[model samples]
Target chain A: EAGVVQSPRYKIIEKKQPVAFWCNPISGHNTLYWYLQNLGQGPELLIRYENEEAVDDSQLPKDRFSAERLKGVDSTLKIQPAELGDSAVYLCASSLQGQETQYFGPGTRLLVL
Target chain B: GIQVEQSPPDLILQEGANSTLRCNFSDSVNNLQWFHQNPWGQLINLFYIPSGTKQNGRLSATTVATERYSLLYISSSQTTDSGVYFCAVDEYGNKLVFGAGTILRVKS
Candidate 1:
């Protein structure tokens, strides 16, 4: 089966610009997650969705970052007026409900100048 | 929140050599996973070993849940095996806490 898919593998924007990343989870997977990875560091959870409900988003920066999984199969993470610190790799992963194994996409590399 | 620590932080090996990576966690966990992030930034699942041992080709992993530690073994390493290896644990069964990761460089 195909793995999780993400769009616009690489994006570049100036500081204070708006940017968005999209993700498509694997088939039949009921749990989707978004993570941010800085250089030389492991990924940190940003948001998680169980079906269409966001079960965890405490780590997300609500002031500038927002995410939604409307139909439950696809998700979009947005950053409005992104800051220079917002430059990082945005990764999307999915797994079957109740399963701990998660598969990740190639990730979207964002660079804010 | 739980703490995860990885040892060595970096490893360098020549082709055909073998090496081991270690991960130590601070609390009990329901799920543990090993992942390899390629130079292109794609995370590939290496193993989902919550307990016991599992082997796949040249790679193998063992997790001692009771001890709150895991080990990943790579045998006869190749240049392609060079990447960052991460150990992640889910204490509540949903959120994963990851270690800083071990950077591996296999020179051919």
Candidate 2:
């Protein structure tokens, strides 16, 4: 099966501008996830979806960051009025089940100037 | 929220050498996994071992769930092994908390 797919492998924007990232999970995978990884840091969970239902998003900065999985097969993560601190790599992953091994995609690297 | 810690934040080794990376969790978790992040930022799952030991080729991993720690062993390392190794865990749902990772550099 193909691995998770993400769009616009790299993005650059100015502060206060909005940026969006897209993700397409592997075929047959029921779980999707979005994570943010700052320079020199590991990926931190931003949101998790189980077939179109976002089950975990406590860590997400709701005021500026929002995510949606409309059809359960694809997802979109957006950052409004992006800040310098929001410059990071956004990663997407998928799994066959809730507790199964997760497969990740080549992250979308964002740079906010 | 859970806390995950990885050891030896940075490591350097010569080709044909061996190394071990570790991960420790602050609380009990039913799920644990190891992954390798390449320079391009793709995470490849290494192992999904909540307990016991598993060996694949020259790579091996052991997890002691009761103690909430895991070890990843690489034998006769190669330049291809140079990258960041990360450990992730989750309690109830599939949401995972990842460790900072162990950056390994294997020189030939």
TM-score of each: 0.98, 0.97
Candidate number with greatest lDDT: 1
Give each model's whole-structure lDDT: 0.95, 0.92
What is candidate 2's CA lDDT for residue A64?
96
* Model 2 lDDT, residue A100, Cα: 68
User: For model 2, how does the per-residue alpha-carbon lDDT over B39-61 read when each residue is reduced to its tens digit?
Assistant: 76789999999899999999999
Error of 1 at A107 (Å): 0.4
Question: Would you give the TM-score of chain B in model 1?
Answer: 0.98
Q: Candidate 2, TM-score vs. the true structure?
A: 0.97
DockQ of each: 0.91, 0.86
Worst 10 residues of 2 chain A by lDDT: A94-103
Model 2, docking class: high
Task: Give the per-residue lDDT digits (tens) of candidate 1, residues B1-108.
Answer: 899999879999999999999999999998899999988788999999989999999999999999999999999999999999999999894899999999999998
Residue A104 miss distance in model 2 (angstroms) = 0.4
